[model samples]
Target: MTDAELDLVFKALADPTRRRIIERLDDHPGQTLFEVCAATLAEDGSGLSRQTISQHLDILERAGLVRTARKGRTKIHTADLSPLRLVAGCWLGRFIQED
Candidate 1:
Protein backbone atom coordinates (compact mmCIF):
# COMPACT_ATOMS: atom_id res chain seq x y z
CA MET A 1 0.00 0.00 0.00
CA THR A 2 1.11 3.50 -0.76
CA ASP A 3 1.61 6.07 1.96
CA ALA A 4 -1.76 7.63 1.26
CA GLU A 5 -3.45 4.25 1.27
CA LEU A 6 -1.80 3.29 4.53
CA ASP A 7 -2.86 6.64 5.88
CA LEU A 8 -6.43 5.90 4.96
CA VAL A 9 -6.33 2.55 6.77
CA PHE A 10 -4.80 4.19 9.82
CA LYS A 11 -7.39 6.92 9.73
CA ALA A 12 -10.22 4.43 9.59
CA LEU A 13 -8.78 2.66 12.64
CA ALA A 14 -8.27 5.91 14.53
CA ASP A 15 -11.85 6.06 15.70
CA PRO A 16 -12.92 4.11 18.81
CA THR A 17 -16.21 3.11 17.25
CA ARG A 18 -14.50 1.96 14.10
CA ARG A 19 -12.04 -0.06 16.15
CA ARG A 20 -14.87 -1.82 17.92
CA ILE A 21 -16.58 -2.44 14.62
CA ILE A 22 -13.44 -4.06 13.27
CA GLU A 23 -13.17 -6.16 16.38
CA ARG A 24 -16.76 -7.27 15.92
CA LEU A 25 -16.13 -8.30 12.35
CA ASP A 26 -12.93 -10.06 13.26
CA ASP A 27 -14.67 -12.20 15.86
CA HIS A 28 -17.73 -12.82 13.74
CA PRO A 29 -17.35 -12.45 10.04
CA GLY A 30 -20.32 -11.74 7.76
CA GLN A 31 -22.46 -9.81 10.20
CA THR A 32 -25.48 -7.83 9.09
CA LEU A 33 -25.98 -4.18 9.93
CA PHE A 34 -28.56 -4.95 12.58
CA GLU A 35 -26.33 -7.55 14.20
CA VAL A 36 -23.47 -5.13 14.38
CA CYS A 37 -25.76 -2.46 15.80
CA ALA A 38 -26.94 -4.82 18.50
CA ALA A 39 -23.49 -6.12 19.36
CA THR A 40 -22.10 -2.62 19.85
CA LEU A 41 -24.83 -1.32 22.08
CA ALA A 42 -23.63 0.18 25.33
CA GLU A 43 -24.60 -1.11 28.78
CA ASP A 44 -27.63 1.18 28.84
CA GLY A 45 -28.74 0.05 25.35
CA SER A 46 -27.72 3.34 23.79
CA GLY A 47 -25.29 3.05 20.93
CA LEU A 48 -24.66 4.00 17.34
CA SER A 49 -27.55 3.86 14.94
CA ARG A 50 -27.72 1.81 11.79
CA GLN A 51 -26.90 4.82 9.66
CA THR A 52 -23.79 5.66 11.66
CA ILE A 53 -22.60 2.06 11.51
CA SER A 54 -23.21 2.03 7.78
CA GLN A 55 -21.06 5.13 7.38
CA HIS A 56 -18.26 3.54 9.36
CA LEU A 57 -18.57 0.43 7.22
CA ASP A 58 -18.16 2.52 4.12
CA ILE A 59 -14.97 4.06 5.41
CA LEU A 60 -13.64 0.64 6.37
CA GLU A 61 -14.55 -0.81 2.99
CA ARG A 62 -12.79 2.05 1.25
CA ALA A 63 -9.70 1.43 3.33
CA GLY A 64 -9.74 -2.25 2.24
CA LEU A 65 -10.13 -3.42 5.81
CA VAL A 66 -13.55 -4.89 5.16
CA ARG A 67 -15.81 -6.05 2.32
CA THR A 68 -19.56 -6.38 1.99
CA ALA A 69 -21.65 -8.86 0.05
CA ARG A 70 -25.37 -8.46 -0.41
CA LYS A 71 -27.40 -11.55 0.28
CA GLY A 72 -31.07 -10.99 -0.26
CA ARG A 73 -32.10 -7.91 1.76
CA THR A 74 -29.14 -8.11 4.07
CA LYS A 75 -25.49 -7.19 3.64
CA ILE A 76 -22.77 -9.41 5.10
CA HIS A 77 -19.42 -7.94 5.96
CA THR A 78 -16.14 -9.91 5.98
CA ALA A 79 -12.85 -8.75 7.30
CA ASP A 80 -10.00 -8.39 4.80
CA LEU A 81 -6.72 -8.94 6.58
CA SER A 82 -4.36 -8.42 3.65
CA PRO A 83 -3.72 -4.72 4.10
CA LEU A 84 -3.13 -5.19 7.80
CA ARG A 85 -0.74 -8.02 7.12
CA LEU A 86 1.02 -5.92 4.57
CA VAL A 87 1.49 -3.18 7.08
CA ALA A 88 2.87 -5.71 9.52
CA GLY A 89 5.26 -7.41 7.08
CA CYS A 90 6.41 -4.45 5.03
CA TRP A 91 6.20 -1.58 7.48
CA LEU A 92 6.06 -2.54 11.13
CA GLY A 93 7.93 -5.78 10.77
CA ARG A 94 11.10 -3.84 10.04
CA PHE A 95 11.25 -2.69 13.63
CA ILE A 96 11.66 -6.12 15.20
CA GLN A 97 14.32 -8.79 14.85
CA GLU A 98 14.22 -12.58 15.17
CA ASP A 99 16.32 -12.38 18.33
Candidate 2:
Protein backbone atom coordinates (compact mmCIF):
# COMPACT_ATOMS: atom_id res chain seq x y z
CA MET A 1 0.00 0.00 0.00
CA THR A 2 1.15 3.56 -0.62
CA ASP A 3 2.02 5.89 2.24
CA ALA A 4 -1.24 7.77 1.80
CA GLU A 5 -3.21 4.54 1.80
CA LEU A 6 -1.40 3.38 4.91
CA ASP A 7 -2.24 6.67 6.57
CA LEU A 8 -5.97 6.12 5.92
CA VAL A 9 -5.81 2.57 7.21
CA PHE A 10 -4.12 3.64 10.42
CA LYS A 11 -6.51 6.52 10.86
CA ALA A 12 -9.57 4.31 10.33
CA LEU A 13 -8.41 1.68 12.82
CA ALA A 14 -7.18 4.26 15.33
CA ASP A 15 -10.66 4.74 16.76
CA PRO A 16 -11.67 2.15 19.34
CA THR A 17 -15.18 1.91 17.95
CA ARG A 18 -13.92 1.41 14.43
CA ARG A 19 -11.47 -1.19 15.66
CA ARG A 20 -14.29 -3.07 17.34
CA ILE A 21 -16.34 -2.95 14.18
CA ILE A 22 -13.42 -4.29 12.17
CA GLU A 23 -12.94 -7.09 14.68
CA ARG A 24 -16.59 -8.02 14.43
CA LEU A 25 -16.46 -8.00 10.64
CA ASP A 26 -13.34 -10.12 10.77
CA ASP A 27 -15.26 -12.71 12.73
CA HIS A 28 -18.44 -12.42 10.67
CA PRO A 29 -18.09 -11.37 7.06
CA GLY A 30 -20.77 -9.73 4.87
CA GLN A 31 -22.75 -8.23 7.70
CA THR A 32 -25.39 -5.64 6.96
CA LEU A 33 -25.51 -2.28 8.75
CA PHE A 34 -28.33 -3.41 11.00
CA GLU A 35 -26.52 -6.59 11.92
CA VAL A 36 -23.36 -4.71 12.75
CA CYS A 37 -25.20 -2.15 14.81
CA ALA A 38 -27.07 -4.86 16.65
CA ALA A 39 -23.90 -6.79 17.40
CA THR A 40 -22.14 -3.65 18.56
CA LEU A 41 -25.06 -2.60 20.73
CA ALA A 42 -25.30 -6.06 22.21
CA GLU A 43 -21.65 -5.97 23.21
CA ASP A 44 -21.79 -2.38 24.39
CA GLY A 45 -24.88 -1.41 26.37
CA SER A 46 -24.40 2.27 25.54
CA GLY A 47 -26.22 1.46 22.30
CA LEU A 48 -24.45 2.79 19.27
CA SER A 49 -27.12 4.05 16.92
CA ARG A 50 -27.38 2.89 13.33
CA GLN A 51 -26.48 6.35 12.05
CA THR A 52 -23.30 6.46 14.10
CA ILE A 53 -22.30 3.02 12.89
CA SER A 54 -23.01 4.10 9.33
CA GLN A 55 -20.62 7.00 9.79
CA HIS A 56 -17.95 4.68 11.11
CA LEU A 57 -18.48 2.43 8.11
CA ASP A 58 -18.07 5.46 5.89
CA ILE A 59 -14.68 6.16 7.37
CA LEU A 60 -13.64 2.55 6.96
CA GLU A 61 -14.86 2.60 3.36
CA ARG A 62 -12.84 5.71 2.59
CA ALA A 63 -9.77 4.00 4.06
CA GLY A 64 -10.31 0.99 1.83
CA LEU A 65 -10.65 -1.17 4.89
CA VAL A 66 -14.20 -2.19 4.06
CA ARG A 67 -16.54 -2.45 1.08
CA THR A 68 -20.29 -1.86 0.93
CA ALA A 69 -22.89 -3.08 -1.54
CA ARG A 70 -26.59 -2.62 -1.91
CA LYS A 71 -28.68 -5.70 -1.31
CA GLY A 72 -32.32 -4.88 -2.00
CA ARG A 73 -33.42 -2.55 0.77
CA THR A 74 -30.42 -3.13 3.00
CA LYS A 75 -26.75 -2.40 2.47
CA ILE A 76 -24.21 -5.16 2.96
CA HIS A 77 -20.79 -4.34 4.33
CA THR A 78 -17.76 -6.59 4.10
CA ALA A 79 -14.18 -6.34 5.23
CA ASP A 80 -11.45 -5.85 2.65
CA LEU A 81 -8.08 -7.13 3.84
CA SER A 82 -5.97 -6.72 0.72
CA PRO A 83 -4.88 -3.22 1.55
CA LEU A 84 -4.30 -4.14 5.17
CA ARG A 85 -2.23 -7.20 4.34
CA LEU A 86 -0.31 -5.26 1.73
CA VAL A 87 0.55 -2.58 4.26
CA ALA A 88 1.55 -5.16 6.83
CA GLY A 89 3.77 -7.06 4.45
CA CYS A 90 5.28 -3.96 2.90
CA TRP A 91 5.67 -1.82 6.01
CA LEU A 92 5.42 -3.82 9.24
CA GLY A 93 6.91 -6.95 7.71
CA ARG A 94 10.02 -5.03 6.70
CA PHE A 95 10.65 -4.03 10.30
CA ILE A 96 11.09 -7.61 11.46
CA GLN A 97 14.61 -8.94 10.94
CA GLU A 98 15.45 -12.58 10.21
CA ASP A 99 16.18 -14.61 13.28
Candidate 3:
Protein backbone atom coordinates (compact mmCIF):
# COMPACT_ATOMS: atom_id res chain seq x y z
CA MET A 1 0.00 0.00 0.00
CA THR A 2 1.08 3.53 -0.72
CA ASP A 3 1.51 6.16 2.01
CA ALA A 4 -1.93 7.64 1.31
CA GLU A 5 -3.58 4.25 1.41
CA LEU A 6 -1.88 3.52 4.70
CA ASP A 7 -3.05 6.88 6.02
CA LEU A 8 -6.64 6.12 5.02
CA VAL A 9 -6.51 2.66 6.61
CA PHE A 10 -5.18 4.05 9.86
CA LYS A 11 -7.68 6.89 9.83
CA ALA A 12 -10.59 4.49 9.35
CA LEU A 13 -9.42 2.28 12.18
CA ALA A 14 -8.92 5.25 14.48
CA ASP A 15 -12.60 5.19 15.44
CA PRO A 16 -13.57 2.67 18.08
CA THR A 17 -16.85 1.81 16.39
CA ARG A 18 -15.08 1.24 13.11
CA ARG A 19 -12.57 -1.04 14.77
CA ARG A 20 -15.36 -3.04 16.35
CA ILE A 21 -16.99 -3.31 12.98
CA ILE A 22 -13.76 -4.67 11.54
CA GLU A 23 -13.48 -7.24 14.30
CA ARG A 24 -17.05 -8.31 13.74
CA LEU A 25 -16.43 -8.60 10.04
CA ASP A 26 -13.33 -10.65 10.65
CA ASP A 27 -15.39 -13.14 12.58
CA HIS A 28 -18.31 -13.01 10.22
CA PRO A 29 -17.05 -12.81 6.68
CA GLY A 30 -20.25 -11.74 4.89
CA GLN A 31 -22.73 -9.84 6.98
CA THR A 32 -25.58 -7.59 6.11
CA LEU A 33 -26.13 -4.22 7.77
CA PHE A 34 -28.81 -5.65 10.02
CA GLU A 35 -26.56 -8.50 11.08
CA VAL A 36 -23.74 -6.11 11.90
CA CYS A 37 -26.07 -3.80 13.79
CA ALA A 38 -27.45 -6.72 15.75
CA ALA A 39 -23.95 -7.89 16.61
CA THR A 40 -22.93 -4.41 17.72
CA LEU A 41 -26.06 -3.96 19.77
CA ALA A 42 -25.65 -7.38 21.32
CA GLU A 43 -22.14 -6.52 22.43
CA ASP A 44 -22.96 -3.11 23.95
CA GLY A 45 -26.78 -2.91 23.94
CA SER A 46 -26.38 0.77 23.04
CA GLY A 47 -28.11 -0.04 19.75
CA LEU A 48 -26.32 1.34 16.70
CA SER A 49 -28.84 2.26 14.07
CA ARG A 50 -28.60 1.02 10.50
CA GLN A 51 -27.71 4.52 9.31
CA THR A 52 -24.78 4.80 11.70
CA ILE A 53 -23.54 1.38 10.68
CA SER A 54 -23.88 2.36 7.05
CA GLN A 55 -21.70 5.38 7.66
CA HIS A 56 -19.06 3.27 9.35
CA LEU A 57 -19.16 0.83 6.46
CA ASP A 58 -18.71 3.72 4.09
CA ILE A 59 -15.56 4.80 5.88
CA LEU A 60 -14.21 1.26 5.81
CA GLU A 61 -15.04 0.90 2.13
CA ARG A 62 -13.28 4.16 1.37
CA ALA A 63 -10.22 2.99 3.23
CA GLY A 64 -10.17 -0.24 1.19
CA LEU A 65 -10.63 -2.32 4.30
CA VAL A 66 -14.15 -3.47 3.47
CA ARG A 67 -16.34 -4.12 0.46
CA THR A 68 -20.09 -3.80 -0.10
CA ALA A 69 -22.53 -5.38 -2.50
CA ARG A 70 -26.26 -5.25 -2.97
CA LYS A 71 -28.11 -8.46 -2.32
CA GLY A 72 -31.78 -7.96 -3.06
CA ARG A 73 -33.07 -5.60 -0.36
CA THR A 74 -30.01 -5.74 1.84
CA LYS A 75 -26.43 -4.68 1.25
CA ILE A 76 -23.82 -7.28 2.10
CA HIS A 77 -20.55 -6.13 3.61
CA THR A 78 -17.31 -8.14 3.64
CA ALA A 79 -13.83 -7.52 4.95
CA ASP A 80 -11.03 -6.97 2.45
CA LEU A 81 -7.82 -8.26 4.00
CA SER A 82 -5.59 -7.29 1.10
CA PRO A 83 -4.73 -3.85 2.37
CA LEU A 84 -3.87 -5.14 5.80
CA ARG A 85 -1.87 -7.97 4.32
CA LEU A 86 -0.09 -5.54 2.02
CA VAL A 87 0.87 -3.30 4.89
CA ALA A 88 1.95 -6.23 7.00
CA GLY A 89 4.00 -7.80 4.21
CA CYS A 90 5.56 -4.63 2.87
CA TRP A 91 5.74 -2.10 5.69
CA LEU A 92 5.72 -4.09 8.91
CA GLY A 93 7.45 -7.08 7.36
CA ARG A 94 10.35 -4.95 6.23
CA PHE A 95 11.10 -3.94 9.80
CA ILE A 96 11.51 -7.51 11.04
CA GLN A 97 13.63 -8.84 8.20
CA GLU A 98 17.26 -7.99 7.40
CA ASP A 99 18.11 -6.15 4.17
**Best TM-score goes to which candidate?**
2
- Computed on alpha carbons, the lDDT of every model, listed in order, comes to 0.85, 0.87, 0.87
* Pairwise TM-score winner, candidates 2 and 3: 2
| TM-score of candidate 2 to 2 decimals | 0.86
lDDT of each residue in 14-94, candidate 2, tens digit only: 999998888888889889988998998888764877899999999999998888888888778888878788877988887
| Regions of model 3 farther than 4 Å from truth | 96-99
CA shift of 61, model 2, Å: 0.8
**RMSD of candidates 1 onward, in order:** 2.1, 1.6, 2.2
Q: Which ten-residue region of model 3 has the weakest summed lDDT?
A: 90-99
- Tell me the lDDT of model 2 at 88: 77
How does model 1 fare in lDDT? 0.85
Score candidate 1 by TM-score against the native.
0.85
Query: How do the residues 8-98 of candidate 1 rate in per-residue lDDT, one tens digit apiece?
Result: 7889989988888888799899998888888888532656778998899999999999999998988899888788888788777878645
Q: What is the C-alpha lDDT profile of model 3 across 53-87, one tens digit per residue?
A: 88999989999899988888877888887888887
| Clash pairs detected, candidate 2 | none
